[model samples]
Target: MRLSNTLLALGLTAVEATQFWHNTGTKSGWDAYTHEHKGTVDEVTDQVYKGSTALRMTQIHDSSYSGRYHSEAVKFNAYKKGDTGFYGFAFRLQDNWQFSPAQGYNLAQFITDFSDLNCGEDYMPSTMVWIDGDQLATRVKYGEVCPTDQQKIKSFDGLKKVTAGVWHRVEIQASWKSDNTGFFKLWYDGEKVVEAYNLPTNVGDGRPFQFRVGLYANAWHDHGYEGTQGTRQVWYDQIAAGDAFADAAPDKW
Candidate 1:
């Protein structure tokens, strides 16, 4: 669902502002959908968290293909430099997922294109959530979107224990601010794992960043599929963004 009038404004009391809700039951509702190499994003009915269907994101490691592995659904204009919003999604890993000696598997991110700066970086991401080993982690990227002294990223790891073959809820609420006046809070399965205030939630640029949720096997690109399982599967459902938690939460709305 693009930023449009038809987007869902969900809540006990709708905020009267533009919000988004996608059940992940279909492939045609998102602003954009993308995949790479042997990766695929499909709607599946066998495993679902909401409605009758959910999105299954799969990625196969191809040693011959040296590209980023991603199968994601994108929502544009999710936020900017000075906006505040809540984003939530429910995801489940494959029943046979390998956790020991685990590599990185990115689940969601807020990214924006910064090619206009030509700083050797293309689309730089601001906030990202992922699973590292058996723990869930997240990060915040700040500084100028271009070549600058302050361009840097800081990570927060060991948030919670991650399990496979089960539904897990993730909710992130942020007050986007370039200065040290913003706040970022993340909830994992209704447990508040990370909470920080007076921090830089994103870069100083004003470009509109998109919220994307899926299986992005970035470890394959950087660390070379360390796990024995070349084919990875993850299911996502009830992806949403809104002005408040109830509007974006899968169970609340």
Candidate 2:
């Protein structure tokens, strides 16, 4: 479908913030998940599933923070073959956080060499919908893997870069033009970053997998590395899931 037509059909607009669950750091809010550190780390607050609590991570032992936070309330439905939609998030990762496989899924993350001492060597799986491949963020190894036929499309290395330790917005839009004409695009901080046409596969098309928003930390699998002595934290706010409608349109039904 043409971008203009798709936008019209979706009526792209910002829905009421209240329609979403606010997970921040505050009192009397939803708690999707929370963990506290004992050593040098402290308490990490959770406002998961639209609460007023801030997700927190405290620093303690070897080259990293001790806690991690994630929300259980926000989840996405699996897409059919021709289904199309948009997804995005904004977050910040702390510096002290170690590069471990067990980081779980931080709303914000840091990517490093898998062989690095601090950087753990393991593929952290995310519940988030992504083109199937070995390298999670970039398409350095192969390309977009189509679930239906196991076909590979454009090189994923063209995808935008995600800067660590900073707050940025990464937005993705997937639409079906025809069985073979569908495409996907990503935007960073309102700037178009990556656009791919004629995707090898169609999402939401008879696939049994639904998109999920969560974190995956594989550090626990590393040898000689025990779980974080304390908790590491990343904060995610203003998360929404649904189809994108007309430009600047509110996301209300």
Candidate 3:
């Protein structure tokens, strides 16, 4: 069993937190936390990790416009600089997913809209988790908050290939900071894949960032579609964010 599931089975509650929050992706839960959601976002019973239902996000190939295929849920003011917290969720990619080479499918991200300033930076995402082909990848962007020229992205790729039709857990602990005092760590199914210390993890400004999880077919926009599967879908459950691992871990709640 995965560590999160193990914890739940053992009924462990050691970790403490400022807030213990969990979203089962029910109708009320989905409606309360998301806004400006595009494409198809629904609660389905076809597949679920812990609860009776899960959030299913679907995106189809849109040839009319060259925008992103985003069907993600957002939680505004989720975190800010100097805050150390854990965020986690359980997800499963669709079976028979086309694991084409060089195609990217975004899973979760932490971003905010900075378009009102009009300083060359619009909607910028600081951290993102995605799948490149069959392998899992994630990236962290730091330095200036605005303008692409002022940003620096550090990416960690080729962690592990995901298994379609099976549920997986992802947990992240981040110390949000713009200077060299922050740290970032990620655990996939209880194994630590990436750990970096004393690095810039967020924009220089102390603005709050939103945390979101869903399917964003970026390859369609960046490199155009390259696979037979044009439609994509993913399921998410036990979405949480808090200061302790138990607070965010799916099974722990």
By lDDT, who's the top model here? Answer: 1
Q: lDDT per prediction?
A: 0.83, 0.36, 0.79
What would the TM-scores of all predictions be? 0.92, 0.49, 0.89
Q: How many residue-pair clashes does candidate 2 contain?
A: 50
Report clashes for each candidate as comma-separated counts. Answer: 1, 50, 0
Query: TM-score for model 2?
Result: 0.49
* Model 3 per-residue lDDT tens digits across residues 66-140: 777888876656677777888899999999887998799999999888888789878788899999889989988
**Tens digits of per-residue lDDT for model 1, 1-253:** 1344544332212333545554445566677777998889998899999788889999999889999998998877778888888889999999999985559999999987878888888888789999998799998888887675568777899999999999999999998888899889999999999999988988988888988899999998988778588999999988777777876777775
Model 3, stretches more than 4 Å misplaced? 1-17, 30-38
Candidate 1's C-alpha runs over 4 A off are 1-20
State in Å the error of residue 134, model 3.
0.7
- Candidate 2 residue spans exceeding 4 A from truth: 1-74, 98-155, 158-164, 176-179, 202-205, 218-231, 245-253
Residue pairs with clashing backbones, model 1: 1-30
Task: Quote the positional error of residue 186 for candidate 1 in Å.
Answer: 0.3
